[model samples]
Target: MGFATYQLDRTNIASALTGGFASAISVNQNTINLGNQLMFLGVIVLEIPSNVALQRIGPRRWISAQVFIFGVIAALQIFVRNRTGFLLTRSILGLAEAGYIPAAMYTLSTWYTKEALTKRIAVFFFGMFGGSAVSPLLGAGLLKLDGKGGLSGWQWIFLLEGIWSIVASILLISLLPERKLEAPEKTISSDEESVSKSEIWNKATSETISLRIVWKTLTNVYKWPHFLATACVFSTWSPLTTYTPSIIMALGFSRIKANALAAVGSLITLPVIVFFAWLSDTTCKRGLTVMLSIVCYLITLIVLRCLQPHVGKWSRVGLWTAVNGLAVGYHPIHNAWIQVNCKSPAERSIIVMSATAGLMAGTQIFRSDETAEFYPRGLLIMIILAICGLALVALQSCIYYVRNRSNSDSVEEV
Candidate 1:
């Protein structure tokens, strides 16, 4: 619920900001892009540190506090009269929201086995994507209150979503479970047993959040591929999330109708995400499943790029909806794969946080100017990045396969 409310505010504010808020504050496209970049910057800076704090203060307290602080900052956006105010509020909100996702993910990892983690993470992401799907719909309705209480439609959107976040934070404070570390389970394979014998793995049950642990996790060679792959693929999502409604509006729809229509793709995403999660768990092939999901997204991008000029507005809408629906289908599976490969809980915390920081780096990919040409340059960039990400995923999977086979051979020899 907390994540859902946060995502609702995050996405709802985007639609509102680009429409009514931009006009109200007299800010240009560059200002909007810069504000978003700065917000993501703040999140990148605080991601690891926030995870450290989560370890010290506990998930219930730390996460709830984060939710409440960001909610307040989001609500305060209603007062922004200029670009500086807008940028400042956005940065502060990012700081407040820094580690909520990773914190929640780490907490879930502590409770579930590797086999179960993908489905659980999918359910967790359902909250996020669910909020995303609902945001534009809610915004469409709230936009009708444009002149009520002397507040603009954008102001009403922010105010209501912010209030919902606050309420959800309070609920989280009462409901979130305290962290409880469990003993490591016995491994069935030689590769798994080898991991259990590692020095870091021995410390898997530790509750301490030491600087050394953090540094070690940061330097772990195994995690960099995951981080880089995440950055590459997630960068592509920035333009989609920020510009979809505007793009729909450009197709000759009214602002309210565009906002309402934007929800269709995200609504489609909910079931697609669930299906991919099931596929990953059922096949026990996380990498290949993620690759398949990415391929589906890449196909949409390719088709959209090729046929966009020839298609009618309705056909473009269908293509865009397909793109949005496939955008995040692989995310939960990738996260589970990362967690399953980590040797310790501390490592999971740091790597998860770092991977999310990579995602933050992606928010700057879609420039304001790119929208003029229907993002030909942006789409090309995303295609290239997706290919790079796909290659990395394949390489990492092969590496693991070879290493596991070698380990099994050595065990048989012994």
Candidate 2:
């Protein structure tokens, strides 16, 4: 999903920011922002399976369903030209991709103890870096095909890229393991696993998440201050995924050059993505790792708004590069942290899906108003969110301290 966005956003911005093109387009900021919100519509499609399918269909059948669905979506892009066809293809792809992130993290939860979950999450989220790194390369390559065959290369870009996702879905199923739960005995095979996931969610989740129980998990999710704080951090971090190239253009770079520089930052994240995951796993300091990452992000926003306007191309690239690498780290920790705090698997799925939904509900919180001008004002707002996140982190730390401070007597006796 991250890779798809990287290519789509890069290509979209490349076209939008080109001087001779799109000068006649007269849509309001709301419309363009609405297009961006289509991403969340995409998210909704993806999260449905994650929230409802894993336990309902089970992993084996659901994954097999996803693989079959992936091929169909890819093939649809092969012949479709109308908006309806295109939208249907994307919405289906969205549903297929949606099952991945939260599902992967939740799957990781089953693998490691709580202390080790954060690192696993960081490794999983390295896809952002991987996607970012590859997106520009893909975009820059695709831009070369722009005028070929009287069809926009962007169309071909979509068609060809779907293959990658389809192939990936197949390979990944072989790698993902399904553990036997502490429930009634039933045999699970590769083919049956996806269907069984739905069984877990439907037949199983009834205990904690029936129509009556759903509200308990749902309402309790928002009752935590940490979840709200984390949402703020995530909502801000989102633009880095979808709008980094836009932000770079705000600093007066050409679209292609801006995207290429975005790649530079994308490249810088590789080591951090690997090493940070390792540290989070080893240390169990998921929240602390996130706090540090957000600090980098806060500093990046400051640099983009304040220093970027004044910096030379050489220095600007350096700053934006740092921004890309640092900005992505906050998410893995938050993804893991939410699950860690939840008392049950049912609640964990609820919190992950709900928080992600809130992140998608960005139109209400930080409405994207500036279409042509990359609004630096948005950065100011997000910075405040980051600070609030820090405050929440501090509160959590103090809570832990107070709870454990009195343990010295028992430790000494032992």
**Candidate No. with top TM-score:** 1
For model 1, the superposed segments whose C-alpha errors exceed 4 Å read: 113-115, 180-205, 409-414
lDDT of 2 by residue, 198-316 (tens): 34443432433344445676565333555676677766645565566656666687666666777777777777666665666678776676677778778887877688657686676
lDDT (Cα, tens digit) per residue for candidate 1, span 1-414: 877887876666667854578878888767877777777778767877888888788788999999988888888888999888988998888788887787887777656554566567778878988988898888888888899999988998888889888888899999888854455454557455533323233245345557888888778675577877887887787667777888888899987899888999999998898888788778978889989999999999999889888889999999989999998888878877887776666676666554455556666666777676678877888888889888988877877776678787531100
The alpha-carbon lDDT assigned to residue 330 of candidate 2 equals 63
TM-score of each: 0.90, 0.73
Model 2 misplaced stretches (Cα beyond 4 Å): 1-29, 45-50, 67-96, 110-116, 173-177, 180-213, 221-223, 247-256, 275-284, 362-373, 400-414
* Residue 78 C-alpha lDDT in model 2: 41
Q: What are the RMSD figures for all models against the true structure? A: 4.3, 7.4
